[model samples]
Target: MSTNARLQANPRIDAIEQVCSKELLAQTAPHDTAPPGLSETRSDGPLSSADDVEQYGLSWETRAALEHSHCRLSLESQSGHSAHRTSMDRETSDTDGNTYPEGGLEAWLVVFGSWAGLFAALGLVNTIGTFQTYLETHQLKEYGYRSTGWIFGMYAFLTFFCGVQIGPIFDAKGPRFLVFAGSVLVVVQMITLGFCTQYWHFMLVIGVTGGLGASLIFTPAISAIGHFFNEKRGVATGIAATGGSVGGIIFPLILEKLFPLIGFSWATRVVGLICLILVLLACLLVKSRLPKKPASKENVLPDFRIFREPKFALTTAGIFFIEWGLFVPISYISSYALAHGVSSQFSYQILAVLNAGSFFGRWIPGYVADSLGHYNTLIATVALCLVCNACLWLPAGDSVPVLVVYCIIFGFASGSNISLAPVCISQLCKVENYGRYYATSYTIVSFGTLTGIPIAGEILSQCNGEYWGVVTFATCC
Candidate 1:
């Protein structure tokens, strides 16, 4: 049969072509273009304009191209565009058609920048144990564990809670100013932290200033990656998150050696210098994919309505428990070791060992989550953390070998909780609203961060210096 005969024979195929032409013209026209061939009298009827037929070219060659089965299928797949609309829809869809445009090099660089930024920011979070351990023995020695816990708790609280406001700000302003400002705050905190001799001083410098700096840098650093990749988001995000683990590894080792050599002040200054360099790279390379939204007071504020989604509410609860328990070991493992007669050097190194394992933990699981679902992977990791806390940390007594093992295993397992939670939240919302969702969720979770350490400290105090109470509280909480 002739090609025209085939198209004319199939009424459904003719209807599709007519619909495509009308939709294309409607989209291309400045105002609603009148339906191609309809008068007001038959406006509701199907269009059949000579202009449409002429524009589409009813020539033998054009008909042949449209009639070819392969060509027809290709044309149908690309039905919406008329070779003029170049803007690819990067928006997330309920349908599974969303994809990234610039695949390899560009996406990878964004991931790299995110990793570097996370390393400098989250690295400090992971090493909280080292700071807690050192401070408890030196500057804050007069205060009980419960009293000192407030400082770290506040730090963690600000690190996350501040993101609520910062997320919205990031979406409106882009990351450049936020990241640069954050870098400055972090450098200032590190430089000043060493000079802190009193409890209030530590709270002011590390808890408030340091926490704010971290939140500023961290929200934008991580969020910018979503602008670049969709399919490989898990792997890319994971690769970026490993920076925290790397920082965890490096910071502790540096602190351990530097503490003895130049005293705490100079040691922190050196670390601050390192963070300065890394953060500069992050500021330069890390960027948003979407144009900055116009800023307004309304847009900058977080909307709590997202909790209307049941899955997000449950996920938030899960994260709350995870964060609540997370800081215990980081804040106390060194103190536990020191109290148990382990040398100071080994005690600090324990944090490094955990972070070293975490470096791998961040990357490997991210690769896995790409194939497996992000939430599925996160749930499994959370379960693993519960096991590590229950089995390894619970039984770790005065034995160096046992404590060391616990640190490495728990460090790796918990690393996923830090890195994957944002991705899981991203999965729940549109890519554009990711900053809002992430900010809102963590704002609530920040309360957990604020009090988790102090509560653990109280548990320690209640147990008359025995760590079992603190460990049990950490496990249960």
Candidate 2:
């Protein structure tokens, strides 16, 4: 029907009272232009007058929304109506999940929770190279690079893979239990990691425990933010994602300092303690704005069937390739530096520098995505990643400055792979089913994470320890 009729009948406007500040709404339409039809008795009548809107006991948010939708409906009628109507209809349909508070004290609290959880979750994913490098030298010294790769590869694998189930759970149950369980598991992973000495120990304790915890924490963390914001989602998601970069920088620097003094056991324990605090914040503050859907036979299981949609399928493929290229650097930069005769201190510090650039990468691209198309921003950043790998990293062997340049540039470009991917995925699906679509895409992409690191290591081995093979594989992909 007409946008005006749909706007009034829409149940979503009822939620406006919960989200909009009445004072803010009162300011949006200061002057009254009351039409004859609206009255104190009318609830969902056509807003005949702006003055009548205030008199109907409608919320300021609802009144303002009616006014705005009415104006847009008028403009579309004046212009070409069909195409605009179709687009507007699809966007505003309740099933598509467009209405969100977008801003409020409660919403920002969810953002804070997401940020803190990502710090503990993705921050460590970003720091895998540091972990890989250290374990190669110390704990897993007997293992080849290819073998050691499996431990961390599996860790990254489970991080995203588990989202297949977790995403659906988040949709049905909200984020409370998932965030809590994830927090406890990750803390245990870090604390127990300090005591690991064997290959199997690292595999079971870290590879399994850490990976699952990361998935549990991040899937809900990212999904919850979607419930509260829409127009600013790109920037907001980017802001939350910077928590990973923040964690990446801090964890490395802390480990760099503490590992030397306190040793691995105590050093890891320290990191665990810090994650405990952050994850606790996530547990307490992170919440879903949407009411939970009761479990259903149809909705309980994740529908992998969504990939039948071409747009979603293509988007998933795009992310799979971009992410395939992305993690190679994150998981191996420190090792690449050390192999080139970079000092031990600089090698450890380099991952921190990559993460430093990533901090800006996460925020800036997200801000830009709100203005530019989210997919447009993601595509550009992906291209940037390809160029950096080929031009800078492929040539720089033992050239500290070039390696530094590569780290900074690549780190920045790759940052959006995590932050913007969700925004891109959300655009293609109904908002209510966002977590499912997001998890499904990343569930496919997660296989790339599972396989990408080991393939790089194998490539490294086949090239007789040359860095170019792995770099070339990542660039070409």
Candidate 3:
């Protein structure tokens, strides 16, 4: 038969699948559960699927396993040729393993669009300290640190929390409408932030509105890139994510300088204008290549049943811990510097420095991850976070050099943590289902985002305004 010949259903494929299923079941730990919507499918005969022989390449080991299996399997052709086969199909990609263009002007443009959108969304997330410090001193000076923490924490929570519904929407409708809507909300948040004077005003404008805008922009921004790159997904995602770090570095510096000249009201409007311009570019360029699927019950609504997959469950847990530790530093470094007697001028600069390091951190880990293993890179980078917290930041009070070193090392490591997370999540499911898995994982992780900063704030309060309590909590998480 020709290489292109579509082989029909065969016993070899069926037998190999049965053996693989049995092996998978045998390998599952007692606590591990089957994946949602997948494990429940079965029959007394071969499972229903259109997969062909070539798609299920069988090797010697597969033949050996079949020999031990109960099925009567044979791979010989009519001409007496011996057959070879290996593992069953692992990925359930909707497009059946489509190849990417890798690089082109159009492809690069899409990546750039994604970068710009994430810049507005995650960049603000990275620059939360600048806002937190200013808020404490200005509009909401009477509130305790824990109360302020709740505001930012809610912002962080909505950034991911709303993604549960948005992810499935992206999978069904495409990126254009979502990006457009996000652009409007973000502009509104920025423009309105300048006028807010009360604690509730900040909560409504920055916390809730801004958070929803970010979810609308970023969820679709990240999802659109996957349609264009598969082999180089790590590098592409890393490149796009650098926008957040770049935004982090740039925005704080702008606010630090502009706050005095323009004051809070106009400075935020300036940032809003900047966001508007970039978000326009994002709306124009970021697009999905996959044909849009109609809204289905599974794709339109949030489902929590995906937790049955143990790998996904463990991955989500790892993300929760990473996020739990991640924001404590981002939200408090400026405050920490001020408390340690650092100059006010330089206190604002520290966040910029941290973000500057993260710019480089995001790209390098991604470039190398493709060559190494995705999970391997993630594990190493997360360990870097723990070390930076326990060994470096914990003892570095009032020491300029120590703070600087901590910023560069920890900033870079945490940047890798942000960029690598979705990449690792991509490994746990099919490409088409990537959004579902990513959103679900983040929905669970959002609670960490919701509580982490506030808990850290309470820790700071408990230590009589000392940062060590928060640092220790961050290290342990």
Q: RMSD to native for every prediction? A: 8.9, 11.0, 14.9
Q: Which residue runs of candidate 2 sit more than 4 Å off their true CA positions?
A: 1-97
Candidate 2 C-alpha lDDT tens digits along 333-359: 999999999999989999999999999
Model 3: per-residue Cα lDDT over 245-334, one tens digit each: 999999999999999998999999999999999999999999887778877796688878999999999999999999988999999999
Error of 1 at 343 (Å): 1.3
329 in model 3: Cα distance from truth in Å?
Answer: 0.5
- Any runs in candidate 1 off by more than 4 Å, and if so which? 1-99
lDDT of 2: 0.84
**Against the hidden true structure, what lDDT does model 3 obtain?**
0.83
Best candidate, lDDT: 2
lDDT of 1: 0.80
Model 3 alpha-carbon miss at residue 210, Å: 0.5
The residue pairs in collision within model 1 are 119-243, 129-330
TM-score each candidate: 0.80, 0.81, 0.80
How far does residue 449 in candidate 3 sit from its true spot (Å)? 0.5
With a 3 Å backbone cut-off (N, CA, C), the pairs that clash in candidate 3 are: 57-86, 58-84, 58-85, 58-86, 59-85, 59-86
Which is superior by lDDT, 1 or 3? 3
